[model samples]
Target: MSQLITEVQPDVEIYIQSIYQTVVQRNPHEVEFHQAVSEFLESMAPVIKKHPEYQKYAILERIVEPERLISFRVPWVDDQGKVQVNRGFRVQFNSTLGPYKGGLRFHKSVNASIIKFLGFEQTFKNALTGQPIGGGKGGSDFDPKGKSDLEIMRFCQSFMTELYKYMGSDVDVPAGDIGVGGREIGFLFGQYKRIRSGNEPGVLTGKGIGYGGSLGRTEATGYGCIYFLQEMLASQGLELAGRQTVVSGSGNVSIFAIQKAQELGAHVVACSDSSGYIFDPNGIQLETVKQIKLVEAGRISDYTLHHPEASYYEGSTNIWNVDCEIALPCATQNELNEVAARQLIDNGVIAIAEGANMPTTLEAVHILLANNILFAPGKAANAGGVAVSALEMAQNSMRLSWSFDEVDGRLKKIMQHIYQDSIEAAEDYGFEGNLVAGSNIAGFKKVAEAMIAQGIV
Candidate 1:
């Protein structure tokens, strides 16, 4: 992780390293969190040199730690009438800009390390959106797959019964992530309302449209990534039109990214799920993918059943092997490693936009940058989801909703600004055209400035 930091003044690099060491000591065995902190601090070396006051105020040290970490036991009864328990967590990382805002993920991989990493990343991601939202993240290790609807509802109820006490319209707003989706959000929202005996839709986002969700929230993250990609490509005098694309993960993010990329004239040739990936040389059939993933909640393998022309691979990561000019990793964190990055680079990948948080490893990121490939970090590229979530919060406060076009327009503009802001921050700090450093610096400066203004708390 220390090797990730480069091109820094000696004193600044030492300071950054020291802060990262303390972070690791304080949170041992939290590999994901350590990776996130190290990657972020790598960008801070220049910032520390440019802004000496940040060091005087200990911004790096303070920013790495969370304001609060809440863990509780979620107890529920399964369909077999047996009692079950799972650990739930909420890491309120930072609220300097505004209230805590992030998402709740439900998966077997949920742990303090993962949550902290996501929350830490979310803090910067939210800051880049130009929206009044801070950073936080929560979830349980309860796997929703293969669970009955009733069982899932019971779990959500139990989770909400304990979580609602810390949530409110202006306190913290949680949306959907990995395992939690519209159905799960509805259950959590219902339990929150039932417990408080009040109607406050603003307390939660990614809700059902009937219950106050925004029209374009589902499509925001994917569309926003493409928008950011558009700006990044435009910066290099390139365009997305007719470019060969490969988007990993067939979930909401990947699906919408493919759809939007196609709309903008990119030909998405490959997409995947946890089980496997499909390479459709004729361009992916979005409707069939939507049916398997969204409608039936089925596997990506079923896609071949609908269209015999497409080729399905057994492993998910192999999707990168397909030659493409644009590669968007929309799957889990670290899904694309140095090897996959080399594959992309050797195969002539011109651009990569992370639709998932930290999907590419630190080494992979360096390799891509070293190759002069246009790369957009997830914090900046994937801010679309939370950007639209903030818009949903605004709509809820106003008791009104905007049309899809309206919300989408706002989302597009926000992404444009984020791209510009990142580039400006990078250039200002002598890391010109480095979106990774640019995004990290821009977001850290925003939150750090706010934290300083608010004083040591």
Candidate 2:
């Protein structure tokens, strides 16, 4: 795909491309990390042109590289007593804003590249949240699916044994992501406490409520996505009420996004899992979905057993084929590509907000922007998860828990401010109405300014 810096001055374009090429050469085979850095550096063209100090101070060079990368072995015994080994990683991308913060995924797809990409994106996402958290990500290539409770517990214990050495309330704070959730968090936190001999709840987020978890952390990312969508629609004198929407993914983020969009009067007709997607023209029954996915822990195809009227398809990404006014890609990175973007556009998609990190490819993003569709990048739209994580850190420090309503209200306000900040930043940099550039610039400027203020580290 062509880079977004093409339209800028030749010198600026050359500078941006040089940085990107350097990133590629230094981090060979890390396609995901390369993609993230390319997208970020492309947005830096206007910034570098307007503020040459960033170049003078070598901010671009420093920001693209992670401060630390920790790789360790995680060996655990399965239920059958056979030993297994999985590689784990923690990419501390940046700490200029504050301590490193991000989630720990436990999917088989996880590797150094995936962790670095997530950490790089988390840095900007945390910055946009107006929180003190820095950017980091960690996970293992350990597939949590089909693992028994004891097996998972053993794995968590083994993983945290190595990871706990680097974690602290004032240092790195890891949360749940992908295959990691409340149950996994409980096991990991238990292991951390056992090893460290301290009750530092702030060391992690997404804990069970009876423990030290925040009330609305589970719904923050999904609900925050809709809140951002609400603000984006309102900018054009539009309302979410009565809009037809399709949200991909059936995980925590997707489920809550569907719930909030429905609450606001939008008809969310479709959601998906890795196996396939389910479309309910009568509007998805959130309770049934929760029961099947969360309680029963079954496949999304089973959603049709409860509601025969709905149709289930075998392809997950094909969910975009369903016609809708709004599209929320809440699934993993690059779930929606150029074809999906064009499909949504052909079907009259007026707006899109990413609920997952870089869910849409750069090509898809360009296609959406060229068509004048309202696009909210994941960094700005899905910052809610990390934002609430920051809040949970505060709550843990104060030894107080906020009510669900209180946390939700705060999440809404933070999302609003992020949207507004993106708008103002975009306009200030002569990229008015282009939220992709706006969000990148807004987030980049915040971290870059901090990096400059603190001097070379």
Candidate 3:
């Protein structure tokens, strides 16, 4: 660690320690939650030093503890007339900048600690986007896999019945994440509208274009990551053209990343899902990948069915060992570890951009920085999704819609601005192109200033 980063703010350190202890006591095995908290504290040390008033606010303590943690019993009837109940949570972490803006995840692992960590990260990430959105995250532990459409609809209605009371277009706007998609958003939004008894189009994003959704929200995160990587590569007189890229996850971000990389003349060799990964040395066929993952909703193992030449691996981590010029982890937190980082470094990978939140572990980040690899953290690189969501809100509020090209052009501009801002902030902080420090400092300053202006609220 750099001496500058090692100099901890005493109050911040104490607060972080308290959070760590409390979380550990509650969920001792949540390694990812602990890792997220540690990274937040490490990045926040400089913020505390620059804004001593943050200590007065005890922002670290307040941030660790959400403003409101809503957990409810979600009971719904299944297609078989069987009753099912699952726990749902919404952690409105902060509201300093504006209304809470974040995604609602629907995975089996959703919990208070996970939601808290995600919500906390969203605060800074949303701030970095220069958007008038605050931070909050909600989700449920109920897995949406294998559920009938009617069953899923029932569950979403049940979930939103409670969520709608606390959310609005100008209050907290939710979007899709992890297991939440167009279908899920449609159900949730329908329920919200029914309960609220009014048509509030801006209450959610990632809706189908027939609704009030923006045109480019689906591709924003992936395309934005490529834009940031392009800027980084350009700084070194390199380009994505002819570069070999590896992307993990077969979800929205990874799929669009593959498409954008191919459009930029890069050969994307690998993409993965929860079941495993598929490697196509001749470059993954984007259409085929889309059909298999998106249309079929099948495991990546089925990818070999379409192209027998492609090989399938049974684990997600193997994507990092495919020897590519660039690596993008679009899966989940800590997908890239020290071993994977070392493999990429040894293979001469030039750059790494996270398409997922905190995909690279702290050790992997340290190794990448030590090796001088161009790396863009998820907060800056993936802000395009949320930025476009904010734009969607604007469009909804104005009862307007933008053309696909227009929305895409705006997304590109926002992404480029975020990259340049991060770089400039890094240079100003004496790090000189270190985007990790740059993003942290850039995002921290905005939220800290907002908190100060809000007068300790």
Query: Each candidate's TM vs. the true structure?
Result: 0.99, 0.99, 0.95
Clashing pairs in 3: none
Q: Which parts of model 2 have CA positions greater than 4 angstroms off?
A: 1-3
- Which candidate gets the maximum lDDT versus the true structure? 1
Assess the local accuracy of residue 336 in candidate 2 as a C-alpha lDDT between 0 and 100.
96
- What ranges in model 1 sit over 4 Å off? 1-7
TM-score of predicted model 3? 0.95
Model 1 over residues 1-457: C-alpha lDDT tens digits?
A: 5454567778787777789889989999999999898888877776787789999998888899999999999999999999999999999999999999999999999999999999999999999999999999999999999999999999999999999989988999999999999999999999999999989999999999999999999999999999999999998899999999999998899999999999999999999999889999999999999998999989999988988999999899999999999999999999999999999999989999999999999999989988899999999999999999999999999999899999999999999999999999989987789999999999999999998999998
Candidate 2's displacement at residue 346, Å, is 0.7
lDDT of 3 by residue, 82-103 (tens): 9999999898888888899999
lDDT of 1 at 237: 95
Candidates' lDDT values, in order? 0.94, 0.93, 0.86
Clashes found in each candidate (C-alpha, N, C closer than 3 A): 0, 0, 0
- What TM-score number comes out for model 2? 0.99
| Candidate 1 accuracy as TM-score | 0.99
Q: Could you arrange the candidates by lDDT from highest to lowest?
A: 1, 2, 3
Better of 1 and 2 by lDDT: 1
